[model samples]
Every structure is written in structure tokens, then in C-alpha cells.
Target: MALTGKLEIDVEIKAPPDKFHDMFCNRPHHSQHACNDKIKGCDLHDGDWGTVGSVIFWSYVRDGKAKTLKEVVEAIDSEKNSITFRVLEGDVMKDFKSYVITIQASPKSGGEGSIVHWTMEYEKQHEGIAHPEDALQFAVEISKDIDSHLTQGN
Candidate 1:
């Protein structure tokens, strides 16, 4: 069986695309306030926000377990409104040799809201390990939380 795989998920949000993209690029730490239940907090370990090669540490609860992750900002494309992160260490590294996630927020074709797209790519340590579907679900939920947080005042 193949050991490398990818998963893509998209969620619709009432928040504007620019604001949604800004959260990922320059204000990821705000996630703690937006969704403390899942995202405990995030801190900058090196460099600055919205810059390539920045290192960030994340704390969160998943599957009723607390987990930590260290990731580097791999790429950023403002025109595309996307950011890519490469996981250096974390709960997921226990099962995957390498993991990368890319997220993009774009304007919906019809009008007012945005569409957030999450893509995860991984190489499993063993064929027995399952895919990261739960992570995708978490992303979806977090997108909603962020949407609500951003749209609450409007």
C-alpha cells in the first residue's frame, strides 16, 4: 500500500476571505480566543508572523488528549491568500514521517462569505496507520469558530 497521502477539505464561512487569511498569516495566536476548546494557544518561537521561515508552537486538544506541535512557515502567497506549514515535531510525527498542511481562504463565487480550504499531506511511518480525517474535521470546526468570532460584531 502507498504510504504517502493527501487530504483536502473546504468549509464555507461568513467571514470575509481577507480576514480569514489574515488570521492564518498574521494572527494565528488569536485562535486561542476564537476557539479555546480546541486551540489552547499558539506562540511565536522565531522570526515574525506572516514571514517565511518563522517557527511557531501550538498547543491544542484533540481526541480528548492535549498535544503540542512545532512548525515552520514554509510558504506564503498573499495573492493566493494561502499559507503552508511544515511540521517539525508534534503528536502527528509519532505516526507520520513527514506532514505538511496548506490552507487558503478565498471569496465565494456567489458573494458575501469565504471558502476556506485545508490540505494535508503526509507520509506514514507504517501502512497500518490511518489517515488524518479527524484533523480535517477539527479544521472544519475551527473555521466555523473563526467565522463566528470575526462576524460577531458585524
Candidate 2:
């Protein structure tokens, strides 16, 4: 099996695309409010939110286990409503040599919703480790939670 892999997942949400994009880019620290069960909190370590080169720390749960990640905002494109994060430190580094997560939101055609796409790219430390399906699932679940939270106006 190849040591490097990429995973992509698309989610359809009933919330506005701009709102979703803004959440990830401008107020990621508030994600816990949308999915408290999965995300404990996110804190700004350096720089400002919604800008490239900013450092952010995440506290979250995966497979019932608590974990943390420190990531730097690698890119942000308002025109595409996309944000990319490069993992700088975390448990993920133990199994993967490098990891990058990119999320994009686009308005649904003829609708009042959006299509959210999450892409994860990583290189495994060795061939024995399995693909990061669990991580993709985590992103999907968080997307759903955020959708629900926004649709319910909570």
C-alpha cells in the first residue's frame, strides 16, 4: 500500500455557505459550541483569526479518546470559501509524517444551503498504519453538527 494517501468527503448542509466558511475561518475557536461532544475547544496561539500563518490549537475527542492538535493556517481564499490547515504538532504526527486539512464551502444551486468539502492529505510513518478514515469521519460529524447548530439558530 502507498504510504501517502488522501481522503475527501462532501457534506450537504442546510446552512448558508458564507456562514459555514466564516465559522471555520473567522471563529474556529467557537466550534466547540456547535459540537461540544466532539470538540472541547480551539484557542488562538498566535496571529489573528481568518488569516494565513495564524497558529491555532484544537482540543477534541476521537473514537472516545481525547486528543489535541496544533495547526497553522496555511491558506485562505475568500473567493472560494476555502481554508487550509497544516498540522504542526499533535498525536497525529506520531502516525503520520505530515498532514494537511482543507475545507471548502460552496452555495448549493437553486437552494438556500451549501456543499461542504473536506480533504485530508497525509503520509504515514509506515505501511502498517491504516488510512485516516476515522479523521475524515470526525470532520464529517463536526460539519453535520455545525450545520444543525446553525439551522436551529443555536
Candidate 3:
């Protein structure tokens, strides 16, 4: 079965997309203990940081155990300030099989405001492995944290 969700948040970034994207995609910059010690590492294997098709590996704690997630860039539109990535291997790989996550930002009408959108699409291996809404809520929380960090002048 297929599952999907969308999350939206308002943010004010001290830096532009290029800067914001680079910092967030890098993972380490925002994965500190205070933010989330669960992450042990995130590496971009191909192309430069924030470029389409770059692979990233994330190590984290899940279910009281350590797990790693591997993902690849599926799409990117700098002009629209969007990037999409698909999970390839790792803990959730067995159950979800595949997942696509996208992040995008649009300039608010006033030019001082901005809206960030986070979307996820996934295919489940079994009939009842994970609830789509649960994943969506987690994604929303992560997005909110990221937005808050940048807007807080971090």
C-alpha cells in the first residue's frame, strides 16, 4: 500500500535557500545533541552538498536500538527552493520498502515571510507495518525544529 503526508511551517531564515539548504542537508550542523543526539552521522556520497542525486547516510537511535538510513536525492529545483530524496536502504527499508521525502520553500507575499513544506510518500511491505499519519507527525516535528532553529538566529 501507499502512504503519504504533507507538513507546512512558517519560518524566517537569516540565510537564503542556498545557505539554508546546505546547512540542513549536511545534517551534522543541525544534528547536535541538543537538537537530536540520535543522529550519529550523515554523509553525502556523490556530487556537492545539496546537489541532486547525492546520497546520504544517517545513523540514529530508533526503538532503543541503533539504526542507519540510506537515501538518495531524487529531485531538486533550486529556483523553487525544493529538494526530493528517496530512501534506499536501512532499518525502515524492510517495512516501508521505499520512501520519498521532499522539502520546499516559497516566498511569502510580503517578502519577509516564508512557508516551508515537507512531503513524504512511502510504500509498505506488509499490510500493517507503519501508520502513515505517525510518520507524517514525526516529519512535521522535525521540520518545525529546523525552522525554529534557523529563525531563532542559530
Candidate 4:
């Protein structure tokens, strides 16, 4: 089996695409209010929000255990509504040699909803580590939570 792998998942959300993209680019910390069970909090470590090279720390739960991840904003494309985060330090580093996460929100044609695409690229330290299916599921769940929060006027 290959030690390096990539997972991509696309989910349909009821929220606006620009709003979803702005949340991650400008105010990721606010997601805690909507998906606190999965993502506890996000803190700015360096640089300013919505800028490349900014560092952010994330607290979350995985497999019923709390974990933390520190990452730097690697790239951002406003026209494409995408942001990429390169993992710097965290539990994932223990198992994976490298990890990158990219999220993109594309507005549906002539519709009020959006299709959110989440991609995870990683190289495992060894073959013993399983694929990050849980992480992908978590992202989809969080997207759904945010959609629900927005549609409910919360």
C-alpha cells in the first residue's frame, strides 16, 4: 500500500458560498459556536486573519479524545473561494510526516446553496497508520452543522 494518500469529499450546504469562505478566511474562530463538539476553538497565533502565512491553533476532538493542531495558512484564493492550511505541529504530526488541508466553497448556479469541497493530503510515517477517513467525516459533519446554524438563523 502507498504511504501517501489524499482524501476528497464534497458536501452540499444550504449556506452561501461566499459566507462560508469568509468564515474560514476571516473569522474561523467563530466556528466554535456552531461546531463546538467537533471543533472546540481556534486561536490566532501570528499574522492577521485572512492573510497567507498566518498561523492558527485548533482544538478539536477525534476518536473521543481531545487533540490540538497548529497550522499556517499556506494559500488563499478569493476568486476560487479556497484556503489551504499546512500543518505545523500537532497530533497528526506524530503519525504523518506531512499534512495539508484545503477547503473550497463553490456557489451553485442560480441557487442559494453551495458545494463545499474538503481535501486532505498526507504522507504517513509508516504503513501502520490508517487512512484519515474519520477526519474527512468530521469535516463533512462540521459543514452540515454550520449549514444548520445558518439556516436556523442562529
Candidate 5:
């Protein structure tokens, strides 16, 4: 019954690593266009997309229930193809005191596709709250949708 925990998973994609990085760092607001069902909307609240300190709001469906959350772009490194998001409000905030998600896409050695790594670190509001496994799965699906959309013609 630890108050803090970390969950990590990796998803393989046919698209290149740069493709994944470009989407999250460049046109994240258009993610809904990639997956209409999972992601309902992505709006910019402050600063601009692809830059650090930007605030973004997301509306989506997770586990058959509608959910919403806001996050600030904590960091983005093009060289490593990594981006970090610090959760600020909405559904996730209700159960956790702090939530941070970091995604990194890297080329698989001697392979055409990329390996996308997901890391979620959070502190529960109380010991009763379960770890956010569903949320991480939801993120995986979202990344897959974006990968499909971006690599459509390539």
C-alpha cells in the first residue's frame, strides 16, 4: 500500500521514432483527428505546442467512461525523442496527488519500426486508490492511433 508508484511499458510501432516525437512535440492538438473514439479533444491552454511550460487540456474516453485532464509540458528533448507531461487537473487529479507521464520513442536496433516507451509516476491521494493501469493502456492505444494516422501514406 505504498503511496507512490511507477508504471512503465513499451509499445512497438511500425513508424519511425521521429514520427512519434513530431506528433507530441509539434501537432498534439490534432491527435483527435487520428483517433476519434479514444481522444475527443486536445486544446492548448497556455504557451504553444512543442515548447516547454505549455499547458494542454485533453478530453478522452478511458475504460468506457469519459475522462478529462490537463497537463503542462514539463520538457521535450528532440535528440532523445522524449517528452514529459505533468498532470494538473481533472480525473487523474482526483485520485492522485501528483502524476507525471513521460514518453520516449527510439529506433529499434536493426529494425524498421520504433519502440515507444511509456512511464507514469504518481503519488496516490490515499492508500485505497489503485494504481493507474488503465490509464497507461489508454495512452498506448492513443499512441498506436497516432502512429497509424501519421504513417498512413508513408
Candidate 6:
């Protein structure tokens, strides 16, 4: 079955989209704080931090055990302030046949603030499996957290 979902959250940022894009795309910076209380280690490989195509490895503690995920950049549009990525390898893959996530940031039309759209697409191993909303929610929450933290200083 094909699965798709999206989440939208408005966050005020002190800096413009350029700065916001840099911070959001920067994997190392994100790796550091990306961890929820359950997360353990996060790492990025290939080129520098946020360059397109770089791979990210994130390990987290769930149910008293460690699990990891590997994802790679699938597309990035700086002019449009959007980035799309897909899971190259990870625990989630065991259940899902395919998974992709995208984030778009656009300056609010005729306004000082900006809007962010997070999208997730996945296919499950079984026809009855649920769409990956929970995974998408994690990304949305962390992204909003970053946006909110940066906005407060502005």
C-alpha cells in the first residue's frame, strides 16, 4: 500500500530563510540537538555537514534498547528553501518497504514570518499497515523546536 502524510507548523525565526535553511539542513548541528530524551548518538557522513546527498545515522534508545536509522539526501532546492530525503537504511525499514521525507520552508507572502511544510511518504510491508505518521511527527516536532529556538533570539 502507498502511504503519504504531511504536517504543517508555523515557527517564528529571528533570522531569514537563508539562516533558517542553513541551520535546518546542517546535520551535525541537528545531530547534536536532534536527540529527544531517548536518543543516544547521531552522526553524519560524506562531505561536510549539510551538503546534498550526505547520509545521517541516528541512534536512539527505545524500550531500553538501542536502535539506529540511516537516511540520505534525495533532493535540495535552496532557492525554494526545500529539502527532500529518503531512508537508505534503518530499523524502520524492517517494517516499511520505502520511506521518504521532505521539508519546505517558504517566506510568508507579504509578511515577516515564514511557513514550513513537512511531508512523509512510505509503503508498508503489509496492506493493512498504518501510514508513518508517528515518524513524520518526530521530524516535525524537532524541526519546529529548532525554528522556535532560533526565532526567540530574533
Off by over 4 Å in 5: none
User: What is the C-alpha lDDT profile of model 6 across 1-154, one tens digit per residue?
Assistant: 3444444445444346765676657643453463455556667766556677788787876556678888887888888888887887888888778778777777867777666667777777776777655655566556566666566646
For model 1, the local distance difference test gives: 0.95
TM-score of decoy 4: 0.95
lDDT of 1 by residue, 27-104 (tens): 999989999999998999999999999999999998899999999999999998999999999898999999999999
Off by over 4 Å in 6: 1-15, 34-40, 61-66
- Top-TM-score candidate index: 1
Q: How well is each residue in 1-154 modelled by candidate 5, as lDDT tens digits?
A: 8999999999888889998889888888788999899889999999988999999999988778999999999999999999999999999999999999999999988979899999999999999999999877887898899889988988
Mark the 10 consecutive residues where model 1 has the least summed lDDT. Answer: 15-24
lDDT of 3 by residue, 1-154 (tens): 4343333434444334554554555443355432474455676666666667787887876446788888887787877777888999998787776777777766656665455666767777777775555555555555555555656754
Which residue pairs show backbone clashes in model 2? none
Candidate 3 lands at a TM-score of 0.73
Clashes of 2: 0
Instruction: Give all TM-scores, in the order shown.
Output: 0.98, 0.97, 0.73, 0.95, 0.97, 0.76
Q: After superposing candidate 4, which stretches have Cα over 4 Å from the reference?
A: none
User: In what order do the candidates fall by lDDT, top score first?
Assistant: 1, 2, 4, 5, 6, 3
lDDT tens digits, residue span 65-114, model 2: 99999999999999999999999999899999999999999999888899
- Model 6, residue 114: displacement in angstroms? 1.6
Model 4 worst lDDT window (10 residues) = 145-154
**What does candidate 4 score in Cα RMSD to the true structure?**
1.3
Poorest stretch of ten by lDDT in candidate 6: 5-14
